[model samples]
Target: MLPNGDIVRQVLLGEKGVCETVSSDALVIDMSTIHPLQTDALIRELQEKGINMMDAPVGRTSVNAIDGTLLILAGGTDEQIARARPILMCMGNELVEAGGPGMGIRVKLINNYMSIALNALSSEAAVLCESLGLNLDVGAIKVMSGTAAGKGHFTTTWPGKVLKGDLSPAFMVDLALKDLRIAVDVARKTGAPLNMGIAAESYYAAASQDGKGRQDWSALLNQVRQQAGL
Candidate 1:
């Protein structure tokens, strides 16, 4: 795997590159995390020259890589994936078929987007907890572990609420907004950098403006989807 799309392009399609060194029969597997559109374009270019290619971006960290237990997200035709499986298995223990051509990188991009952003949000929460004189382990971690705060909305609130089309206000958006404003106010007073919380406040504020304040907090997903015309 290379660092990014530009480097991958340089090594695979540039002067005296893989095209010159490898035969058309060689299957080029790209495990780099790159733009999905770039992955699609590269695959198309490779296929034009009768070269087989697959986007097989791996998941997990370097420790998993060293242990040969990474999760491989493979994007290619079934035949191509079958031919590439043994080679991929050498690097990863699990393989997920992420649809055709460029999907592996697409999934990887989405996963990283959520994870990287959440890292910042998590830091904001940690700092707020510290400023409140709460013990990080006993007060924050232990308390949030069983709730949506730590377990994540996807597995906690979402399934029973908006995902099921309920939106019946198990926790009202207005109440959530009120609580969020309080937290944001506290963070500011404590000199904590809660940028994520500030950004989230705007979304909840928008939801309230859209007359969704009485709806369940999970309905924010629907509000966002509607805003995106999705």
Candidate 2:
């Protein structure tokens, strides 16, 4: 319910805060979408005082909240989460135990990162479509909805390719870079800002330069993971 980590900290652990009144056996479930590190720190502080805590940030929209069908990304020990499940179910229908403490917020952060970034990317594409005189509804949305363009790489490309440990070129990285370059060029010429497209071109260009030109476009995930030492 709190806006950010600072407010949550002040209200929970600051001078004359509620932590002083909380019973040791009471479980504190933080439903805020704050920094994962902050969540971990708060949980540790509460645990030191013999107070159990769980992070259960909900997903979906306020509409889902009204319907009690939100997706709850929970993080805690199995026993701790089990004790909180019935209470959580009253709000969210789908409860995913993301991992141990701090993970719920981690997962939520990643989800939001992708979703929020894609929102801007999607807008860029829509503007490009307009600049190209393409019908946004029929020419773009209708076509993209059935393909990886709209359905997303996670469900389409990654599952069959990189996620399976197969990097064989279904759609080669070189070809992807080429296509992206074309789009970026056209967007620039049409006076449409394709900031996301331009940024994506850099990633594809690097993958190609790393001798992954023949690999599947999904291989970028593998390339990134390797770079991260994962």
Instruction: Give the number of the best model, judged by TM-score.
Output: 2
Pairs of residues clashing in candidate 1:
none
lDDT of 1 at 7: 93
Judge candidate 1 at residue 197 and give its lDDT: 93
lDDT (CA) per prediction: 0.92, 0.91
Residues 42-157 of candidate 1: C-alpha lDDT, one tens digit per residue: 99999999999999998999999999999999999999899999999999999999998888998888888988998898888988999999999976789988788888898999
Q: How many residue pairs clash in all the candidates, one count each? A: 0, 0
Model 2, backbone clash pairs (residues 3+ apart or across chains), number: 0
Best by lDDT: 1
Cα displacement (Å) at residue 93, model 1: 1.9
Per-residue lDDT of model 2, residues 188-214, tens digit only: 899999999988888889899999999
